[model samples]
Target: MRVGKASDTDVEQVGTMREGKLDQKHLLFGEDDSPNNYDLNMGLTGGGGWRTPRHRHNFDQIRYVIQGELPYTETEVLKEGWVGYFPESVHYGPQERAEGLRTMVLQCGGASGQGYLSVARREAVNAELNKVGEFKKGLYHYTDANGVAQTKDGSEAIFEHATGGALRFAAPRYTDVIAMDPDAYDWHKSQDTGVEEKWLGRFTERDLRIGFLRLDAGAVYQAGQFNSIEILFQTKGRVTAGGTEYGPETGYEFLANEGPVQVEAVEPTEFLRMVLHTF
Candidate 1:
């Protein structure tokens, strides 16, 4: 089991085509070679807003809006407390935001068999690409080995070169975006004392699970041994686990067989729980 405080994590600034000047705090990063390997991060888009070109990833991604808003489609916007899921190779975006957009993002290998790449790793590749090409207006301009000027979609070019043309994979489990509002779900009391839960939805094709937990003040909750990777993001009030107190924006990750965990609510608290089963 691993717990982290948002205030304690370093904020990293990465400059790139898709990211712009956004700030990110990495909460968890899974092992590189494992299909279940994943990355969870909180991203903050500052005053000037953020924009990204239309593109697709080899992996799947889920974004939960924590604050502000971003447009998923010309007519659809993701506001606070909303969630959006993007499956592998499903193109969407030309993403844009006006100001103060904050989101928690989870990325993992898609059921399509394509691998996952960390933001850090992707940044490294971007840096290398910069030396040989230039990213401008959401496109990459380069002179290939044949010395011919070429142009390609920025994200497509980067992933292709980074994976050495091995980026293709089986079709994704879901081809369209999935969006939801957790607040719209009904809460169900847990068998555990003082704990109530709301199941958001499950993407069985990707072994993904999502839900919310609400714990009353001074209540204790016991977590059973998990058979998958579990991530908890504090959404309201305060909770203590493993001798550390966590408030909103803080998150924790527990691996399979990590055993039962004891969680205590220092105050009335609520959190979003996401799990990726190994099956």
Candidate 2:
């Protein structure tokens, strides 16, 4: 799995057309920009000549504008920190812009659909962190509504903005290990474990899926089978995702596609586990 911030790696120039003006840097996938796999492409558009003729793809895109506003036909403009999910291809992009555009896009494999963000509809929803309790030795929040309070160790739940943000809760000082198990079909309550657990909650309408995880000192979620793809974010602590181990600064990611794997917390690990649906 790849770890580290999306900007850490130099963008690879896969192909460029029209003299480096409107070229597509192959972000995630291989060189071809072909089909059948997850591909993330970063688009650097030169001011004035940036355009992606109305088209569509066969996957979903989670686009994050890193620099200049990317002009799109859907709403005309998408600013930084602006995330838009477009299913497959719904006829969008490069409407018109005065300056250039740069974006970090996350595309899912075998995905189809068109989704967009209404640039005109930007609202601030007040999100709060319910710090139910303190950590045993560090900064882990140990208060779970589902589990019994005051047990050896408890779990904490913090809510982040529906769209995008860093994290609502910080990792407690003693949170040394991390465990993530995403339930796709069934829901499980947090159990009383001596270790601290941090639950990253992402709310949706359809189904409720949680990255039910926990972390303890010197503990590694030694490669094992998880319910869903384990997307690990190393906020603080030495950890490994898949076969790749990263440090505190490296934002490595690993995907456990319905199998067993190991995620070891080498240091005082503190990260966020995004539970797809909760509430």
Indicate which candidate wins on TM-score: 1
lDDT of 1 by residue, 82-157 (tens): 8887877787777887667888998887765556876676788889999988987678899988999998887777
RMSD of 2: 21.5
Candidate 1 all-Cα RMSD: 1.9
lDDT for every model? 0.79, 0.39
| Model 2 lDDT tens row, 1-279 | 444454455644322211235534432341122232344455666645543434343333445465677655656556663445444334354345444666655454322111222111111121132234443321234445778654221111111222354222221212111112222223333332223554423322322222334455556553223333334434466665665657643333344444344566666665434211111
**Clashing residue pairs in candidate 1, if any?**
none
TM-scores for all candidates?
0.92, 0.42
